[model samples]
Target: MTDPADRGAFIWYELITDDVAAARTFYRNVVGWEIAAEGQPLPTGGTYRMIARSDGGNAGGVLDMSAEMTAAGARPGWIGYVHHSDVDAAVKAVIDAGGAVHMPPMDMPGVGRMAMVADPQGATFYVMAPTPPEGDPDARSDVFDYAKAQHMRWNELWTTDPDAAVSLYRDLFGWTQEGAMPMGPMGDYKFIQHGGDGIGAIAKAQPGGEGSRWQYFAGVDDIDRACRAVTDSGGTLLGEPQQIPGGEYSAYAHDPSGATIGLVGPRKET
Candidate 1:
């Protein structure tokens, strides 16, 4: 269960893709996650695979996009789930704040209620009121831990309207805007803090870049090795890994299913 004090923190992530088998293989090789062979049955008649870290804690989930979902305009992509106390109220707040609801609030038996919403700029993510497991009310999710490998270390939002997107999220999640780093003509990379931890940054999207979207980075043990695995596993690296401010490295890529993914880690020379 998510702590009440951590309402706005990203507690979960999901990859909605058409090719689950390929995505499973790709991420397993690239991020070293131990994806389950079989998953728990979903109420909607499909299995939802849970991603597990090396410590046996859940990292996130993978949902196989059904034909109906595809025809209804669903695409292969990753979406982060923010913890909310009231998903229905959150949905209303999003709509009232000029955002739109992609998926109306719905309950999944033991999973609690959730809704998919987009920022005013059309960057989509989920807001969930998660139901704690039996006898585990204090269980906190560590899927977004920065120092843990195979966990999400960063959540980068590149939007057509960075200010509006930032404002909408801030209003909805209680996140505060913090210091920023200048990114030349692209604009400032403004950091976002949730519960006093740097969760991610908001940046203006480059011209011709994929429109407003969130790109999550999972921590890897070796940036160089992960880059090699991406290409070796039928994925495409956007560019060479680049060093970041903290003496670490980051890289972006598209998986075999064309879902954008990011990786951050130490640059290990082979």
Candidate 2:
């Protein structure tokens, strides 16, 4: 909304879930978020769930997995949207850049135009042209800061080829590699920055692990406390808090519906 050419910047977040109500409750408790029905229903006759932060900022949404979507192999997971000035042009660029289109461009009555696509390595996300913008482009003052709780703060990509993944984004979103860190044997964890901010990072696909995909991180108040809440609210914590560079901690989890999400927070002192 603020800048149309802000390519490669994550503009919106959406979770396509098998159980919208369960997701609504689980996330509301785990992240202190409040979700409600989108005032208007989609052209398909179903409504989209709006995720709202306590501060009145929008984190993203939860779309009900229609029977058709499930039958067609659309599973439960979160998908991030990239800001693009032209939806059709974005899809074309994705194709020319070696990505595949999962869904063709479709116009939402009120939202804007968008299409779903996967990188050459098969990591999927939306390429969207929101006629009027979606969420707070400046959702966080500093995405590198992990203390901005209850908002969609960061995105991470797991790909088979990190360089190619970074290249595709460079072509699609004008993204640049800010820097990278050695992940020991898994290769470099390459950071992706767009429009002068660190939006997310890319890393090699883990061995015998989940396939290539984009995982979004929502910032919360405390790592220990959120871990407890995640389980208490019917979600599964992936493991213990992972300390990132600069003293911040992050972790991953599986929501009740099996969507993998990430968490960024300050570590609780013992």
Candidate 3:
């Protein structure tokens, strides 16, 4: 069974990329992280590089997309896993809630049970009852520290139907809308809380294909400097760094392998 505290928690982040070396470099420079190759071979048949932070806890894993997998439709992007009490029950609930299963529940021996699913609106993610890593029963890669570079500080979701999406998540994960702000054109930006911890925000997507997905903000020391590093590392900013509602600064960008990522930090004064 997954740890009680981890239920509905974003326990892990995975970057499925076509170019592993390029991804390793881009994130290392941009998020101030280091990649250490995992010694064990994955049951799924790929090398997993562990993203290491300053404090030495892992941040995520990088899986090099094989040509066969890419041809089968694997794209360079981040997929976050929500820890669940039971993978089968989670899959059942997802199907009952009108979502579609991309992969049926499967046990990976060393990795525990996992199933991939897309929400009713089609945003995909994984629900897994993960087997804890060797020594640590509480296996968590995401460390929340907005000031520490290499940590994931914020999570955001832009969906086609905000109200419906919010309802679906509420039913499935027990997340609640803690508060909201009027974004004028963006409608209401709602803060999503799981078990009282405000973890992310959600907004209705603008009229375009880019909306219905999740994006993560990697904490950095300086937003401006991170933007420069993004471009230097073969990534480009979607926009200039702007102040978040609470005064922290952030900017969005596409990584070298085409994965969209964001940088967050306090504004540095001259």
Candidate 3 Cα errors over 4 Å, as ranges: 37-45, 135-147
Give the best candidate by lDDT: 1
lDDT by residue (tens digit), candidate 1, 4-87: 687898999998877777887888999998777776766664568999887888889988877677888878889999999889
Model 1 spans with C-alpha error above 4 angstroms: none
Which of the numbered candidates is closest to the native, going by highest TM-score?
1
The Cα error of candidate 1 at residue 166, in Å, is: 2.0
Candidate 2 clashes between residue pairs 3 or more apart in a chain or in different chains: none
Q: Is candidate 1 or candidate 2 better by lDDT?
A: 1
lDDT for model 3: 0.81
Q: How should the candidates be ordered by lDDT, best one leading? A: 1, 3, 2
Q: What is the C-alpha lDDT of each candidate?
A: 0.88, 0.80, 0.81
Q: Which ten-residue region of model 2 has the weakest summed lDDT? A: 138-147
Backbone clash total for model 1 is 0
TM-score order, best first, reads: 1, 3, 2
